[model samples]
Target: MAILEVGGLTKHFDIRPGLLGRLLSGKRRQTIKAVDGVSFTLEEGTILGLAGESGCGKSTTCMMIAKLHEPTAGTIRFKGRDIAGLDRAGLRDYRLAVQLIFQDPYESLNPRFTVFDLVAEGPRALGIWSREETARRVLEALSLVGLKPEEYKDRFPHQMSGGERQRVGIACALILEPELVIADEPLSMLDVSIRAGILDLLRDLSARLNFSCIYVSHDLSILSNISERLLVMYLGMAMEIGPTDRVVRNPQHPYARALVEAVPVPDPRYKRPIPAIRGEIARPIDPPPGCRFAARCPQAMDACRRDPAPAMREVGPGHFAACHLLDMDAPDSGTAARAL
Candidate 1:
């Protein structure tokens, strides 16, 4: 059974103008569709990668899943229970079961608190453990993240290196032994040299601890290596989703293809032409009808502009894409699919 399931998850932010502007505009409000109808299922002990460019709603989606942001519509089910409808006690339990790992460790960690206090905050807040028990748990968590509690527990965030601070952030999340972890660009702010170590630690810990994870980032190469499955999102909607290797090698959506092509090759001599995606990303506030990506899609046709947004279609085993070009009934559909 899937450990987490999100269906038609949507979050819209109301752009309320200032008093003067509102008076001039007669109270007209604009809505920014930060996350629109994103749906997916994550199996137990598996990692699902969410990849997209900046302002594409990756962080917003993660925040919604973490219950940091309330959704405008849709359902989030954890182990078959709707999170949105949970009562106070249930919500408290949910908070302990799910945790978020922020992008910037320095910013996320409380400088006022020592490493031991940071890791012990959750359990202490819930009043789930005795004073001595909290200390024991904090030490165990510090050890799990490769930090010796006796040596490092008394130190503040400023005392640690970037890599060590990130490990400390990870330990904070794991101290509660969360069942689901939503990691939002946890490696983006860290040094490149230490990224591999963090990734390895995450992989090892997830395997050993048996917790499901949602890893969000704009780094395609890293996601390809770390995630079991990949979901390519654009303008708050999923463009493609499939096995990591398959989607990285052969993306079905035009947006997904452009993202894959944009990855720089390590060899200086190898010069494959990068497929450039034309046009600026459309504004999310009151976006136009039909396919959101049609304005910039290289393969978009008149039908794409006139028709409603396309639904996800299975193009291969366990691979799905939301593109009008994948209309299987069309005569040229086979040709288009083959081109991908």
Candidate 2:
């Protein structure tokens, strides 16, 4: 069953000019489309990897679901209820049921708080359990993350290594027994050697604990290792989404194909092809009506530049992509490879 569902999830940030600039030029406020019309579902006990470039709004989409940002428009449904309409008590419950693991472990934790305090803070703040119970649960959470609670629970964030600190951050979310965990680039700052360990830990814990996960990363290689499904985004819009193997092995969108091809292979003997992307990333502010990726898409045509951005079309079983090349009726559809 799907534990979380999002539909037309859009977030727009408006930039208002300073009083002096407003007086000097009389310029209108501009809007930045951080996340535009994104939709996906997270099944119970499954991991969905959200992949995109840095400015493509993967983190922003997760933040909106975590309630850090009120979406400009869209519906976020968790467990079949609309979160936007939740009451204070309902929202509090939702918060507990959904926890977030931030990208930078060093910045996400409190320097002053020890491992025990950090992990127990959630339940303590909500008064979900007694002090004794919270401590017990904290130790359990630490152990679950592969940290020895007896020796490491008293250590400060500054005292721990990057990988250890990240484990603590995971423990912080796990302690809440949340049904959904949003890990936003959790391994981006860690040493390369330690990334696999953390990835394995998360995959193991998800199975043992039966929790759903939304793992955000710019790297499709990492996502292929841990995620059951993949959602590829570009310029704040979803380009393609499908099963992990399908998306990684047979990406159906030009942007998604570029992203997959960009992943470096380990073998030294293998020759990599030239990337298919070109031109600079289009500005999100006052974006044009056509496809956001048309500027860089190698398969872009006049229709892609002139018509409205294409809606996602099913190109295979459970696989969908938004690209004019997939439109069987378009004049130039046969000119480009239909695979994309």
Number of backbone collisions per candidate: 0, 0
The alpha-carbon lDDT assigned to residue 37 of candidate 1 equals 96
- Candidate 1, residues 75-154, lDDT tens digits: the string is 99999999989999999999999999999999999999999999999899999999999999999999999998899999
Give the C-alpha miss distance for residue 245 in model 2, angstroms: 0.3
- What are the models' TM-scores? 0.93, 0.94
**Regions of model 2 farther than 4 Å from truth:** 17-26, 329-340
lDDT of 2 at 18: 75
lDDT of 2 by residue, 1-340 (tens): 8899999999998888678857864776867898899999888889999999889999889999999999999999999999999999999999999999989999999999999999999999999999889988999999999999999998999999999999999999999999999999999999999999999999999999999999999999999999999999998999999899999989878899999889999998999998799866755876777889988877778878775688887776778888887785454533333444
Shift in Å, residue 253, candidate 1: 0.2
Q: State residue 154's C-alpha deviation in candidate 1, in Å.
A: 1.0
TM-score of decoy 1: 0.93
Output candidate 1 Cα RMSD.
2.8
CA lDDT of each candidate?
A: 0.89, 0.90
| TM-score (C-alpha, index-matched) for candidate 2 | 0.94
